[model samples]
Target chain A: MSGLKNGILVAALLALGACTGNPWDDAAGVGGPGAAGLGAGSALDPQSPAYFQQEVGDRVLFAVDQSSLSEAAKSTLVGQARWLTANPDFIVTIQGHADEQGTREYNLALGARRANAAREFLISQGIAGSRLKVVSFGKERPVEICSNEACYAQNRRAVTVLAGGLTG
Target chain B: MRTYLASLAIGAALVGAAFMATAQTAAAQDGPLRIEITDGVIEPLPYAVPDFVAETPAAAELAREMSRVIAADLSGTGLFREIPASAQIAKINNFDAPISFPDWKAINAQALITGGLSVNGNRVTVRFRGYDVFAERELGTGLQFSGTTDGWRRMAHKVADVIYSRITGESGYFDSRVVFVSESGPKNDRRKRLAIMDYDGANVQYLTNSAAIVLAPRFSPTGDRVLYTSYESGVPQIYVLDVGSVQRRVLSTDEGIMSFAPRFAPDGRTVVYSQAQGGNTDIYTLNIETGQRQRLTSAPSIETAPSFSPDGRQIVFESDRSGAPQLYVMAATGGEARRISFGSGRYGTPVWSPRGDLVAFTKQNKGRFHIGVMRLDGSEERLLTASFLDEGPTWSPNGRVIMFTRETRGENGRALLYSVDISGRNLKPVRTPDGASDPAWSPLQK
Candidate 1:
């Protein structure tokens, strides 16, 4: 146990300790769904107390309403897959986001599909399926705000956030 | 929130009785004599509403303001016009005074509207009457409306609606309610809750607490109930609320799915909504009365924004079945889904017209969003608005107009409610107390 009295714990150490308990608890957050979810846990876990502290790698962007990864996006993702492969004890989350042109729910689904597409591509690139996760903010998180195509292009992106550090 | 409404800035003064002071001075300001009955099409009744016949000097201004508000309320709708209080050759003395119908007819006035208001302890009662000079019979019986000292303006609009309905044979659109999401805080962390207000955007009443984010609030066919989606339980879920008592209950919480975008079926016993599960969403129907749910769609493609036809036989929804979001229709029983949207980059949030004639939806073509309506078969697509974001079109009870939320794109985002007639003649913003979205116009309350 790393309960060394006066040592300051890095976020990776904290996340790794939290992850040792359960993955669902890591995802579900405090008062979120337990392992037996749906009804056993509360309907909403607004704040994830057990928030992930995965190291962020390279980012990926897509075209408007298009989740297809560009060459640059693919190359950056290659770098991400390499980093994830080196950190064998870590699990990663892929968050997909879209610009604000589409409806809220549709954007959410688009984000989900985009995240999944990214995760699948990573799995194809040698990352273990269980080591990867995905979430979609839909149009909720717009990195750009202009009405033109440029802003939307920047917003339609898949971000890889890593968590749970490997230990000896 | 109604209690909070008790504190908003009260608008215009209640109308006072018109008193016949002098015919000579009043006759000098006659506006115009425009009255006609051509081809069996009855035009708005022309009236010479001389400032109310004020009996006391203090009552003179209240009388004038009341008459002006009345004329503005009527003629502002492009319906009626003032024949000038001066046009009345024979002055009608007072509201309850004996009057000869011939005197008003002599000036070619088709209708006469007069009101008298009495101020009591912190309250006012407006007594208004409408008469059809052409038919020589009272159009709407004399109506008495009581309001707080500040609610005189609403009482006045209510009076105008009574006259409009009594003469036009159509239910009054005024006096109805609009329920929407009130936004506060920064754009990134918006806190939204359900709010109800008068159709004119007066007397905003917050219905739900801001403990959670609420979205897509749809009014029940009856004004007393509201159907909306809440994020209270982490997952977005639908809830039905009693507008009067503010009592609420979760409508559908099936397993791990998220239910949102709810609208009542015509029967009011059931609601159609989109349930998201496993990264996919499909339409589902919930019998709120019996706690039963029937899945209407089984496609892995995203199927959402389901709206039932007026008769509940067919459904119009937005689906990504065509590789992009497009409009589609199928039997309410879920069979033979036909693609209805052809000219579009992406379309979502389709609401069937209450008249059973058309479906309104949000379309994103060439990266710009537009609010458009098409026939049930997706034949005639007419885009009503083009903007950064214009979604969630809710129709007036008459089906003549559709109102939707419009959010202007910028670092500082602002969402407002706007309405456009199906004819596209009247495109106006519905005034709201704060930033508003997901406005559902309630059916005209009886």
Candidate 2:
């Protein structure tokens, strides 16, 4: 039964890979073992935003003061793009956040860059730009509220939140 | 010890000369023994502020309250030590009563302040005189302030500013306001709104509701308008607010760009802020009246947190163009920039001091954040406060002190406001109704 679930998830992700124009681009990590594990949960409940938030993973982390997406971030965003493509009825706002390491205004700008990066990537993956809006909370809101590196890593992220509407 | 001059028996003229010589030496030896300290750190001068004499029944409570505030203002500076009422050796019953210098001297009080108050219906008057008790003379001219009863605290602050300026040789920062972000809610989803209060964190008035997130509230040169970034429209945009009527309008709404970290030029007509476009952020200035816009920095690297010098001829800002964030200065019109900070750490939030002598900034070095200052030439850098998370520094109006936000680390962490002197003394937490950050001190009240 597990093998069948893994097969189905791999097939779906490989279909997503076919949407891309370049085969040499292994940056998305499509059809990998990670995809099988992510398929274990209720992959996509078309009716539930909670399923999209919890199962699809709402956020992606970035390196210190960086808005560029890492390979791991790209892989997670691939999953997000797939889910967002499936749930076209939902409009999402991507909130970019930063660690407490930089100044307030700089962090705000960095957050904006991060959110834009995420928004642009989602759009590239066939999600409509109008469906994805972006806002930057800067260092104002931190998921992990510690000053040390462990927490800073988690705090530097861009999160996609569903505004919850069937029609925009 | 007395000096005796050797005199000839040439007459009374010679005798008089000898007497005058002896008297001159005696006067030199016994003169007022006053300490004229021009500068440098010394013990806080001890002073006494007896309750102000109330000339009418309506003034009784306000008189005491005014004196209390005056004492708090002086003592709060950490430059003057208030001799408590318990330590008072004598009290002045009349506003014009002679100061008992001997009593003050006996108690080691270096200065004394005597005040009188009168209230009739809606009007109030405060008369105050500062005395250099040891020198046995009134220090500076006695002054009186008149205002409505509702504005009694402002009158008290003005009186204190007068006294503080007379003694400290620098202008006072007590009669100023601070605009900051008030925060609440859980860590992951905190809410922030723009709020303004006195320099001492009193008279808090919320300028914007918390329905949307706001960051970096800055005061206009005249303190009549506030510039802040709000996410009310689901995107970060700058909004200018009239502080008096609470009316607000979007300052800039360039298509598909995020603008934040705004500051008013010294002239108050133009504003400088950071706007992010196509994943690139830079600084821009806008004329409020004519709606003219100018791009200050076009670097691919991020450039934000721009502050104008008091003279408005130049601007100091933080940029990551040097690979790591560092302080830089450029002409107000924007051109080639000269790097100002060569330190080993990341430097940001460079706010030029109103005095034009130093720029206060936040530095992150070796896993610690600090609030620090440096001269305009990028020399004499001094870190004032060090902690896990200390950022967003704003200069006091007189440029004697700085207030910034410091956040603690944990799952339940929160941000608090703090102020410290430029001399790196008297670090105190500013009292707020809730968590606060991004403090911008307003110019001295008119």
Candidate 3:
């Protein structure tokens, strides 16, 4: 039942993306003569952080009380790894979070495990370990505030946040 | 925070000529005024505290306020009920006057408390006595206390503590404080600051600003220091703060590793906390003075929230070694642990009671969270509360009550502090200016 609902939600999001003129679909005709011009830092630009977040997906969700990565999560991480490699000047921090179903201390440890899993996968995909740092917010920070499983699924995620100027 | 009042001056000699003999022997004979707290249903012993007599003109308001505070401290315990002064047939106009036993019996007041207050410049003095109306004798020795006028509330609590101990035969928890994380803002972007307040949620003082996230503030054995986890360095690290000076320093736990759930040992010099490294979390003990470290548990699964028994002989903690979180007991020095929670649920955050009789914990079973207590052997588990989310149980000084954090469900959910007796009775919310969580009760003040 949830899978069917998720499919509908994804289809609706794609329809909205088409209306917004998603740049990934227009990238093939970009830079050609008389083609629509796109700014370098705009969300439509493939090399921008905005594009990485919207098109490539910066976050991956997890199951309840489990830190192991799923197949869909791996696919998202692959895109994240490629973006990180292409933009070598940016350093990323993997923020791991959990739902409000567990104790505070245990959730913290679980978040750490999730962030470390993402960090390890990125390293395996040819990204330097030095450019990747991990921090667990536990259940303290949630993207969705509802108490149902849909919100919890969105809250239990690891996001790759990029910052300019890599010190290392 | 209020100028740090001087230590209370306890009068040495007993007062009142009616103190013919020690009330301890009389109480031992099973008087009609006794209350057995372990009973299934308590009647709430009826007690009365008339407005204390003001010996000086300037002490009239202070006397009345102090009397109210004393009555509140006693009635808040859920074991006693305070009869209103309007219900009293005999008014105490003089502190030293002989009590009218028949008038008190007429109102069905089993216990009576009388007090006198005097003010001289910045110095204030209070004297109080407890009585058993049925026996027509004093319950305990009359006592006197002297302190600055700013400490009037604490003086009242001291008097209430004495009366409570004399009647219940157990130490009172009124003269203690609680350290917690004060929260504000919405659920998604909540801000947390370290805060300390009196046991009854009075005199709240913020120890740290909300610039950084802080969690699990714990008081030292002497209530002079607090240890908590902060993300000031962008990673969770334990920091110890002196309560009086408000000065803080982070304990050294290696860089780039997450350390949290810090708790002070009974000796006050050592700390036990969880450290996460390489995605594996384990428990470790660190000595504050020597910078020495000891690995208490090297389990592959999560092991955290370690608490020491009052005797400092054993430690109770939570671990997921059995594929799910459960309570475990091991020596304070470290070794093989014995699993103590056999029930059908996941358990974490086990805190040993100060009296060394039971361990309080948070259990999540069938989608509901509960605050529960169990015997040392894991037998006779009794849940005190059930809510959408309830965690982090901290014991009162006397081990008769447990305070925990309860968060409501939905987008507008917020955390609040709630306390309950060990018998699963008297559940009520503690008032805080903002949202609060992670409460740690301090030992009784010296």
Candidate 4:
């Protein structure tokens, strides 16, 4: 069942890539298309961290004071789980975050819940629990700096940060 | 008038009477000089503190500085207004001289503080007195304190505490310390270090370096040790540090579990804190010496920020069992809890006042945050301040004042320590070397 889901996910990604002509175009927001300068091993490479972070979406956003995964967030996590399965040598740390709308202690716990939610989803997708670790930054780290819902929506997120290399 | 004269004679003869006894006598008289703090909309009692008399040449500067600190301490409460020396109708050149009632009354000074300072090599002695200027009598017995020259500020605070206690019939918070997380850098990558300072933000001493992230430094009941959460081990863990030695050790817990929001019980032997495991959080009490842990709350919702009541028999904490964070009170050992906050928005960081009658907390409502206080039964909820982000309130040793963190809005937002009276007045910023938050006030110094 898991293999069949991956096959269809890969087929959909390839069809989407063919339509865009450049698979790296969707990642322009990270730092333009070829910023990594890796050439053949650049963000254009499907297995690269840049591709996972940008094209496949490394982070899932949450609503204000919420930790339950949204449908959009689940879709992104499914892609993340597929990539993790393909790259078994990479150990990923799921970082949960919250907006500045809550207390310091509550936000810390909320961030943990969000990160755990993402971790559980990946585990359900057959990723080994040992290959994943979770941390909650709470509201300490934010990708954006505004005070409105726009910035808050971005801050309340769980990002899968990949660590270690293909040592195996 | 007869009772006032009799108490005045006792105050003069027993110059060393316990402050509580003297204050009680004055309070029993129901003198016009009393400032009823519970009464709303108080007109600040105008008072004067002329430069203390310098008996020795080396004491001149110290005398002047101490007098200024005393005046600042009294006026900072917003209950007392200092009448500047420039407006004083009389000069207090001699500490033992009879107070010129007519001169003080002419300047509308309702109360007066006069003192003398003497320095002998490294030793310094300060003697001070408070007077009901309009009554033409001393407010309390004169008192003297002796300490080393390096401890002049503490001696000054002692004087102010005595004056405050005498006038208001309540213990003073001036002679206390606060341990807090001092922050530097930007919003995302802030560097935090544990720092301790005088309650008035003087004599700051960094307890830890900014090498790791630290949050919520809480002072022990005796103020000699600090409890806080540090990420030095790559995860949140509770640590206790001796303020005098600056040495610390992590509290052992089940591996991989996160612990934060630690508070020392009044007995200083046990700590009530929040522990998270398996994506669920709950409150737990730990015996610091024995390493024994007891689960306090088994709710599926988040339960953290537990504060012990002054008597140590009860604990007040924040929980989201009702779907949004609110204040709840339970036995120190924990079981069933009664919700103490029924407000519209979320409430968190509930700190029981040292007085044990009120609990201070951070409230968020309608997109604005407030530092508020509510009674034990969840009645008489009063919001003291409103801002973009205001949370984590710590009470003064006296419980009359609350110090909390207030963060600005937007990209350049920074957290700063601010304080307000429980009556919702005299909101002011506490000076720090840089951005600061999560203030935990220590009990009055011994």
Candidate 5:
């Protein structure tokens, strides 16, 4: 009976796969409405979330599983902080991610530490604490799906996403 | 061996008229009949379970299905082998047929199980008896179970449990459930939701949608509630979800704090998890009823993944205070901690077994991950599996097997659930729709 069920499931998956688009291409940009720019709008305003994500760089990569910011990561966060301060109408959430190297719970904790580290730096640079929220996806979501160190380095990252709405 | 005499009382009502004595019965009365399984390497005991006799026309198909389920449950344990019905020389068409002992013993069948089923309206009843072919006598008294038709599978499991316990002197794990993270979409932006299913990967039910990311769901001692970390509030906070109603409330209600890796204590009323404050992570406990909280660890470094001992006297957790992630043992109240892992690799996610003897964890060394077990003091460490990524192990109800997540590396890397025996044999994959990770096995069914 299990074999019969598995056979049907495989057939259904094959049928679905034929019509589905590449998931990686669809998930390339940052999350949220205007930030994704997938099908939201074609116009690129100087102050739009898409412009901030594409032009100002929405993410910063970390080393392995360490949450401590390196020189290059700090430089990227400085640019992100500057962009957020200029675009005062937008609220941002920092999404922390880790490479698939550690355990699930540990990666979650490590991701939290990384996001909090970035949030503190943004706050130190005079961003309001309420404007910046934090969440950690751990290793559940990875941009580069390879196992080698090259792809893992890209997976360990924290992205700042614009809320794209008016907020006090 | 201890036998249930009450089973004899039940047998008198169900098996007396059907009891069959053969020519070897006189010789069987002079010797004891039993089978004991103590080592890993041994031939599985051979048993026969003919299709049950259906008493009513409405029970014809159900009787056969239930018999198949019971056979699969026993054989899947790798401790028993079922002889195909084609090898049978006799057919049991009546519930109370007289002796046919020679027919079964001819096939070298050491054990034989015979049963009958009856369905009346919405209620179903199954009666079964086990026989020792070598002894040429009934192994145990007959037993019967009556339940609603919807619980037919459970009734089959109950029969298998009885047979397993009577023969091996160990409890059965067939009647349990596992909660895990069901993954879909692409690897870069996977959508995860909590799902529950039978131990054999049947009857799956989703507990939550994939609108928000959820992780590390731990079942309560009674299996009524689950403790997990969700990002629904824009930050990771511990949430307690009721399994029956699909309703949930945030347990880590503290403002401006992120909590993850929540686990229920043996008492089920309290929870222990990690909370990050001021860029520092530490372990904390909360009472679900009173809302009281206690700080369990205050190290400057990170400490998380806290699991309680069966007696609730101690907690085994992972900490990086020693310059690397390692296992630690500390009292429940929190004080000085003793490091338990000194191996070459980094270790995390130390879960204490229900039997209170070994701790299962994931170790990383030489760029390879492994699922391994160790004694309470961290001595006698044994690695069970090695792969690109293997982590987050949960023990079977009997503590004989360990289930963990394994992910293949590449552009199409995906996470899947796998299990292995603690003795490092019988490693196998657990089936699920799409991808799965972070499995939490539930206690035996009610």
Candidate 6:
């Protein structure tokens, strides 16, 4: 489960946490978006690094810095609701995010707003409110890597991720 | 009076047109090139750092060589003019005795750097004292170093850093190291590896091999390690590199997620970065020793590029949460966030200055990119440079100048390094062998 040197790791952590003992700080410097959808060749499969069963067409997207549902976003939520309604027992977490063009904390707040925006839209579409959860990445995951306006325009979005499943 | 005023107006218009014409020529093919601090007093300060004169035979030469390098580094920035040893009016007679301020002032040196070195086998101990010329008292007492003799250059830089801090009331950058992606070969197939260099760009050493694509390598305050994003496994992953032994380890392994733009927590233990999951991205932190992952943010918007304030209490990052990419600040522990950028165009690479008063960043307006700085509240925004693209600003330890990447068209499409003072004066090339980007200044060596 681990690779690379052990001493530097210990030293760096000691230096970082020497002042304040914040356990949650472990998640500080992670940025980048890889190919997201579950793939047959993914290491997360039971035969892979870590994998779980995923239903078809399971992800959602958002507009630039907006968590509010547009007509198009509402339509996307309706499609998501149909999937949830058909399954009747799926649990999901909505992760909100901002792009690389704004500040970090505001993006976190904005990411929260966007995730709520999508969650509200899905609930209105008839998905049980409790069956859906929300989280915000705030410009952490970027499908596109460049820093230009074109790339940032696409990175500001909210997504719906399937978590636990309820057996009938 | 009317006729005279017309001639004065005409003369001023001609000068302005000439400058505009040059800018237009640069614009016709590429983008913007302008310097805001057009006029200033640029009289470089003169000081002397004669051979440190180690007390022992083996340490003697090193002391001399190190002092010379320190002198050169200080003068290289064009902020200082070093007095040659040939012009020395008096020798450093004693390391423990009080400095003869009158002797130094007689030579008209506004400042002075005098030190002694004691070589103890493999280890070298250096001690230097700084003087305040007019005050006639010691500005610095014990500026010292105890390190491997082999790293004599770094030791020298450390000495220069101490001298800089004592005189300027600001931290010295000379003692710090620069973490950047070193490049070679053609632009299309250029091979780049994460490398570490002394602040003055000496003793360039590669930290990561070319087997991966490394972007934005940032240094920890201690200067012993680096945090950078690499494409070694064909996806962006945050990795920590140890400077002493040249080893790296992956920090993030969220399946189907790409993690990039890694910056160390001011404390140097954890890191704050962005992770892309599915099609969404958010900022997260990783503890180096313990594989503890805490999700500080949970928004579905794209959040990347997180820089921590010097105190480690807050973080500044770029986001499009406001409908456009702008700078924002939040508590480092994660909480309510506020907007700080209100200029124009897109802004990225917000680097908090070591002085903690300003954040240096890249601002793009009207198709032209600029390197500018603003207060923590996003006020008093000053544009330092304008060019085809001026991004990734790194502050000098003193926060006096900003070093960033500049790219021109044609043969120079590749990025070259340029430097400018915070006042916007003294725009000049940093003299890299080829070109450079992501310039991180080191803390003054104490």
Winner by DockQ = 3
Computed on alpha carbons, the lDDT of every model, listed in order, comes to 0.68, 0.80, 0.85, 0.83, 0.80, 0.65
- For model 3, name the residue pairs that clash: none
Docking class of 1: incorrect
Interface RMSD, every prediction, one decimal place = 4.3, 4.8, 3.3, 4.4, 2.7, 10.3
The ten-residue window of minimal lDDT in model 4 chain A covers A24-33
**Tens digit of per-residue lDDT, candidate 4, span A68-147:** 99998889889999999998888887878899899999999999889899999999999999988887777876655668
Please give me the DockQ of candidate 3 compared with the native complex. 0.43
TM-score per candidate for chain A alone: 0.63, 0.71, 0.73, 0.74, 0.72, 0.61
DockQ-based ranking: 3, 5, 2, 4, 1, 6
Once superposed on the true structure, which residue ranges of model 2 sit more than 4 Å away at CA?
A1-39, A46-56, A82-92, A123-132, A162-168, B1-38
**TM-scores, all models, native as reference:** 0.72, 0.85, 0.89, 0.89, 0.86, 0.62
DockQ of candidate 1 relative to the true structure: 0.22
CA shift of A64, model 6, Å: 15
Residue range A33-137, candidate 2, lDDT tens digits = 234355446555645554555556667889988899999878777878898777777777787889877778888888888988998988888899888877777
True contacts kept of each: 0.36, 0.78, 0.75, 0.59, 0.72, 0.00
Q: Please state the error at residue A72 of candidate 2 in Å.
A: 2.1
Q: lDDT winner among the candidates? A: 3
After superposing candidate 5 on the true structure, give the runs of residues whose Cα lies further than 4 Å from its correct spot.
A1-48, A128-130, A164-168, B1-38
lDDT of 5 at B398: 80
lDDT of 6 by residue, A60-137 (tens): 455654555667556656766777776665577676667654433345556666777777777878788788766555
Q: Is candidate 1 or candidate 5 better by lDDT?
A: 5
Please give the DockQ score of every candidate, comma-separated. 0.22, 0.38, 0.43, 0.32, 0.41, 0.03
Q: What are the per-residue Cα lDDT tens digits for candidate 5 across B305-361?
A: 999999999999999898889999999988988899999989999999999999999
Model 5, global lDDT: 0.80
> What is the TM-score of candidate 5?
0.86
Give the lDDT of residue B177 in candidate 3: 91
